[model samples]
Each structure stands twice: as C-alpha cells, then as structure tokens.
Target: MADNLTKYREKRDLKKTAVPSGGASVKSSNGRRFAIQKHDSTRLHYDLRLELDGVFKSCAATKGPSLDPQDKRLAVEVEDQPLDYGDFEGTIPKELYGGGTVLLWDRGYWEPELNKSPEQALAKATSSSLLEGTGCTVFVLVRMRGNEDEKRTNCS
Candidate 1:
C-alpha cells in the first residue's frame, strides 16, 4: 500500500494540501467503487478514479466522459490517489500541483464485465465496464491496444 502511494505523496506536500496523504488502509467490502470529479485547473477536465487494490486508479478526461454512444473522449492516466480522495470537493491553492476547484461530479460502484478481476482487465484491458452511479449508469468500452499513455473511449 505504501508503494502505491509513493508517487502520490511525492507530488504534493501533505501539510499544505487538503487531500489525503495515505498511510492507514481503508476497509472495503468489494472495492469496486469509483468516482468522477470535475476539476477546474489549468484547463477544464473530469477526473475518473476507480478503486483498485487499496487506492484509486486515476485518469483525467479532457472533454469528460460522454453519455452519447458516438462521442469518444480523450483520457490520460494520472497518479494513484487515496480512496478518500474521491469525496474531496474544494479549491487547491494556485501554486500547488493540482491547483484548482474540484467538484465531486459523480460517484458510486463499478463492476467489470465478463466476470474478470479489475486488475487483470485493466492491465490488458479491451473490455466493457458497468459504472453504476447515483445519477446515471454508464456502459464504458475501454480499450488499451498498445503502450500509449492516452485512451479514447466512447461511453454510453
């Protein structure tokens, strides 16, 4: 767990930031929760964080995830965040790393389709995921064909 948060801690000072600085383990029953945060940073984008292992596997969507089946959004993988980070909604100082206003846009549980483990699917992912949130249910078709850092997905 400490190994996973190494990069996260290095990016920001725990004393100044309002975000969680990871150490203790967060208990979870299924560990299938996910959150989409709308961040107003250097640019406007949505942050998608999926709970995996003991942390949140993060990514930022430039145009945000679309509900239209034909719309594809560009998403880039980011550093892992603590589980509690999903509930954060505040303003980060302008001088800070992720300096901006963050709003918890959507949050709930998610389950990978085909009965496969999330870790197994994400590492070599080219599958569908069922994201059931409080506001809506999104059927996400995630594809990671090569070694590219960016991912384009059409969520319906």
Candidate 2:
C-alpha cells in the first residue's frame, strides 16, 4: 500500500508544470497562455483560467445568483487576477491539503453575447455576467488594463 501511494504521489508530482510566480501558468491548445488559482473557501473553489486576452474570466462554486434548491449555483465572472495566481493549490498546505482532490471539471469555448470572439471580447469590457441556461449560473467579463507585452515569468 505504501509503495502504491508513493508511486501515485510521484506521478501526480510529475504532472505538475512549473507554475509562474505571480500565478499558475497554463498553455492552451492553440499555444495561448493563461493562469489559474484555487480559492481556499469553505466549500472549495477553483478559478478557471485564460490569459489577459484582455480580461480575466472566472467562476466559483457557491449558492450562486439564486438560492432556490432547483437553481444550480455555480457562478463564473470576470475579474482582475494576479499573474502569480496559479500556484495556489498548496498555499494552505496544512489545513486543506490531503483531504481535497483536484480534478478537471470541464472545458470548452465560450462566445460572448456581443459578437466578440474570445480575443475581441476583452476590449469592450464591463463586469462579468452570468449566463443563464448554461451549466454554470454566473459569468463575468473583465478587461486587462495594461500593455499586453509583459513577459511571462516562472512561478517558483
């Protein structure tokens, strides 16, 4: 049993890429860049990631936009996220580490209501909006405020 556990840990560790210091660095399929961070909330939450293509999009697990039992409450929004946000998994190492397991919940492309491609969505930014009828209840749109030429840094 101990050997199995050790091997499992080793494999998990190997799967972890070197996150950037300001945040967790992720490379999308098209070679685009993004970052992710997990919020240490009582109910457990993870921030979905994508680069500042102009803004940071996010979502969380909570009662959401409504409290009705029939109403699903996962919310997604756009907000300003630190570039170093990605390395948050073990931040609270002692309190919530071992008991929690990380998994990929879902992934796909999203289209904004404004006819903006994912790349153009960042320009005409406002607060993130929740998409109804979509699996998650709330969604937000955000825009990046600075020059997009910043170099990516290592997360160590």
Candidate 3:
C-alpha cells in the first residue's frame, strides 16, 4: 500500500537536491506526529502533514490554518511524504523541483477525539457530519500559528 510514494519520489531528484532521501527502513513511530510546512514555491501556502503508517499524508491549505472552529479551511489532499520531511527547512535550487524555501512552521501530535482508532473515528466523524458524502474528511487538532492552545478542525 505504501507504493503511493512513487509520485513524491519521482518528482524529487535526491542527488541533485538537499532533500533527504528517505528509505523504507525508517522506523515508524508509535505515537502520531504532525507538522505544517511553509512552502514558498510557485505560490505561498501552508502544507499540513499528519503522520500515519510511517509516511506523512499531506494537504495543502492556501491561506494557512485557522484557530476558530467557525473558520473552515479547504485542505486538499496531496501525496504521502517521507516522515523525515517533517523537519526539512531549506531552499531548493531555482532550477530544482520545489525550487524555493521550505520552513518548518509548526510541529505537534494529536489524538482522536472520539476515543476510537483514528481511521474509525475519522470515518465516524465524516459520516456523522455528512462530510464523506461530499468528499474525504480529515480531522486534525494541532497548534496553528498564534494559538497557544490546540484546536480541532475538520478539513474536508
């Protein structure tokens, strides 16, 4: 199932770029971790990454994440990234792939609010909220910018 990383690997030339060349041997952590990267590439955007099953599943939020529950952010799912990417902060050559500066915006961990397996809880949340009927529902509780306290937000 982890074969999903093909797109990510294909887009990056590990030898040409300073980006870490992650291998399958990277040990998976038991506890979940998440990070948001401030990517200044073709456009400026905040990339949210949630650690699940070793690789970090990704999403791109154009205007950054919000602390208010009333503010719904549109987080479009992207490809799974290498776990070590959570710590990456550097500049890709203008001619290279990403071709811009990458900053580690925020880092933290999260727990499922409904006390079930993450997948189950998410599925339950989506079904109960009817977000699944529209599209995939992604729930994350994290420390966004300027927020000392963590807030849970649903990204559908």
Candidate 4:
C-alpha cells in the first residue's frame, strides 16, 4: 500500500533533484536516508524528511530551530511528502494553485541524542513532543556534528 503511494507521488508533476554535489556530508552509516524540502503550502513551511525502516517520516515548521531553550515551538506532523519534493522550486499558479516557493533545506540520517538507533529516535518522536509549544517539528539528521572537518552547508 505504501509502495503504491510512493510510486504515485513520484509520478506527480513536481521537480525532483537528488543530493547535489557536496550536499551530503556523508552517507548514513545506519543505511537510512533523509531529505529536507521547503514546501509552498498556504504558508511556507520547512518539510523535514527522514526515511527509516522503509518508511518516510515527516514534520513541518514555519521557522527554523530556536536557540533559546525556553522558546517552545511546535512542529506539525504532515503526510509523507514525495522525495521529489526536495528539489521543488517554483511558483504555483495563483489561479490553479496557490503561489509559493519551495527549496531544499537539508538532508541526512536520523540521529538523536538519547536514542542510538534511527527507529528508536523515530519512535520517540511524537506530534506532542515535536510540536511542543512553538510549533516546530524536530527531525534527526543522520550526520553527526564534527564528523567532517568541513564547513556547514545551507540549502538556498
């Protein structure tokens, strides 16, 4: 059932791009894949993607991560967006579709501070926990900090 949905999504008329050169710092050691997509929904939102156990887990936010520990933001759990959503960038026709822009945000594996496995981290994440109060969904990227001696990469 999920496979069929994935196939249908892939066939949608949306632009899709693989990880650009230097986009990924390193492949996931755990074999999980992930992507970050900027969605042009009614209001712009960042769609964080994490693939685990053959399923795509997703969350969304209108803003990026907050530095202040007190600032509570809630992230909404959205449907599993298509992988092609990663590269989708353009204006949706205002008449037929609401106009908006989409860009790649980030892509990597799912790593959590508490959980050692991707599944564990995913299982631990819930709409209430992720949403918290600020409304920002937290997603675990596979790459570890300081894993590479390279500078941070940002998605335009």
lDDT of each: 0.79, 0.38, 0.66, 0.46
lDDT score, residue 27, model 2? 47
Model 1: residue 7 alpha-carbon error in angstroms: 0.5
Better of 3 and 4 by lDDT: 3
lDDT of 3 by residue, 29-132 (tens): 55677778889988888887777666777877777755556776666667779888888899988788788999987776645555466555333434211111
Model 1: per-residue Cα lDDT over 3-94, one tens digit each: 89899999997888787787655666554888999999999999988888888988888787677878877677788898889888999887
* TM-score, structure 1 vs. true: 0.87
lDDT for 10 (candidate 1): 93
Give the alpha carbon lDDT tens digit for every residue of 94-142 in model 2.
2332234333333333444465555465344442322332244434434
Q: What's the TM-score of every candidate structure?
A: 0.87, 0.35, 0.72, 0.51
Best by lDDT: 1
Backbone clashes per model, in order?
A: 0, 22, 0, 14
Q: Which candidate is the best by TM-score?
A: 1
Ten-residue segment with the worst summed lDDT in candidate 4?
125-134
- For candidate 4, the per-residue lDDT at 129 reads 16
Q: Rank by lDDT, highest first.
A: 1, 3, 4, 2
